[model samples]
Target chain A: MNYQSTELQHQLAARFVVGSMRGLARRRFQRLMMDIPKLRDEVAFWEEHLHELTDTIPIQQPSERVWQRIQSRLGWVQSKTETTSKWPWFFGAFASLLLIVNLVMLIPADPVIAPSIERVAVIQSSEARTLWLIEQREQRLEVAAVGAIERLPNEDYQLWMLPVDGTPPISLGLLPQQGDVILDLGTRIDLAQVAALAVSREPLGGSPEPVPTGPVLYTTDLIRM
Target chain B: MTTPQTLERDLQQIALGDTAAFRRVYEATSAKLYSVSLTIVRRTDWAEEALQDTFIKVWHRAGDYTVAKGSVMSWLISMVRYRSIDLLRNRANQELSTDDFDEIPATDTLDSSLDSLADSKQLRVCMDELQPTTRQAIQLAFVYGLSHQEVSDHLREALGSVKSWIRRGLESLKRCLQR
Candidate 1:
């Protein structure tokens, strides 16, 4: 129970780095680290030893909304907008015109026949290898695999639509490992408000639960074409 | 990938209350941090929540970063990892929810950008020396933030043995790293 014992300090430091130190004992260790420079050094030393293990976790980019939220939380939006004030009013008008054009593109009945692919998203692996190409078609979603993906046994890649409200992702169905597979999404999803497209690794039959049950492998923003 | 020098410079500017510098820091590191959060939390929304909170802390504590504290990336990761561990422990106690706690498939690979770093390469070489079971246990605990009991459930080992493997594994890793 003594924090000053060298043997205890090393043991606690190791557990803390390995993350076995928890609950009240963990909280005690945190305070000890703050108050004792030697204890803090011991923890930092362990941190250096174990920290690089993080490198093995493939880097996944968070959604754009993360920065937006950070800006909102930090009250930086006003400063950001002021910095972008150099843009002319004509630029705003042009953006509005583009939005109108995209809205009109969404009005058609049969999207395959209509020249109205308003948005496209290329979902790539962590290596930046393109895995699936998603395009918003009128009244449906079109998906095609552009690169070779080796499917893991007993596992399927499932797609989900990330909404702006931060709700659990809505399943858009499984992604093809090779070639192209298109499903006719009967109801028109509001692409404008959709935050991003996420792909998760799931069981072969896809997620039985409403939310994805496996690790999210990749995420890409839908771009207005 | 953000070079350490650039990240350190940006952190310094962020400490001085530069929003643009803060944005640069976010742009450079959010993805890696998010990946970490997602792996532990296993949900997009929670991961985003943790990432948001981590960045907010980064914004406020940018001044606290020093060379003695370790790399900028390591500091950022520790903040998120601890927050995520808190979330995991809190949720586990609240409902005994086994909903999101699943063993990650072996095929799931991490970011390739990690391979380019010298530190990563050295760590990988050291990690590769660990027995597969020991390595997996450590990975589950460190990467997924699984507690010893959860790791035991996933690995099908006794609770005491899981703790031994992790403790021994870290000791082995410490020896290997020191060499």
Candidate 2:
């Protein structure tokens, strides 16, 4: 198969743009495009020609925070932490004191944390099959999957906390498919203020972003125990 | 909907690192780009990530755009679609896969409007001429990013049959588009 063949170029470009070319072949095609400008032209031609297919897909508006994230990432906006505080240490100490008080009242619980648990969540399927059981134990979470989670071999399930503040969800680590597992609920959130807990299917090792980067599989309310 | 000319101007301003121009561009095109990303990725989280990455690229690689690239919408759509596809590949990577790959990636409905929006346009005219199954295979391939084998499984046809449909369908589309 000659890489320079015009017909092959056309077929590959069309398939690449139409999205049939993928995996190792897709990577190889991309590498070939660097050496062959004509391949790029073919891809661009296919892109332009087949682009009208997108007009058929309806518009789904992005959340406003995407713009905010872009602005922050581009250094167009000052990070909230970068703001000058008149009483930085005082506020920090006050926050630490509040955290200490909360921790003192609620000791960190282990797997048998039923009595000390403050909140709990159950991730289930539409069939009412319990997929995961979560217990909020002070600053840590105890997550247990009732049974095996039949997931893609390369995929994982991540727990996310939907904030009641209407901000973006905060990742709470990957969920286990079997047995009991404890998760750290980081100091950034208060259990009582959380709106809900969600499980999203992510690539293995979980999402790299500050938020989930996969389809939200199930959402359940955090129940106070 | 900002005019194409305005979009070009926004891209130029973005190249100059102007945030206001970037916002204007985001306001105008983010929805459409997000929609395309979601339609392909089928997840708001990943779609949002793709949209964010696309805009980040738009901000830094604004100089990449050219009038020859077609409209700004086309460029944006192409950019986000590729990003969304990358997410799919990262998760599935089933391009040449033949194993029982039953994962239908997208959840969005893909009922197209070509029949109503069909004009004398070359692409539309040619698309209408395709066999129903061939057109459907192509649509499933493009919209859901399904591979030949996956499309075969989706449409319940033989793998060889689906491959032939796509090969011939693309040929017809190329001949029509080129003309």
TM-score of chain A of each: 0.48, 0.49
For model 1, the TM-score of its B chain against the native B chain is 0.87
Q: List runs of model 1 lying over 4 Å from the truth.
A: A78-225, B94-103, B106-120
lDDT of 2 at A12: 93
Measured against the native two-chain assembly using Cα atoms, what DockQ does each of the candidate structures obtain, in the order listed? 0.23, 0.25
lDDT of 1 by residue, B15-40 (tens): 88888888888888889889888888
The worst-scoring run of ten residues by lDDT in candidate 1 chain A lies at: A84-93
Put down candidate 2 lDDT per residue, A10-90, tens digits, no spaces.
899988998888764665566577568899889888888787877777677898767765564444553343211111011
The residue-by-residue lDDT of candidate 2 on B12-96, one tens digit each, is: 9988988788889988989989988887777787887788878876876787799777778888988889778877766444453
Model 1, residue pairs in steric clash: A58-B110, A58-B111
Fnat of model 2, as a fraction: 0.61
Worst 10 residues of 2 chain B by lDDT: B102-111
Candidate with best TM-score: 2
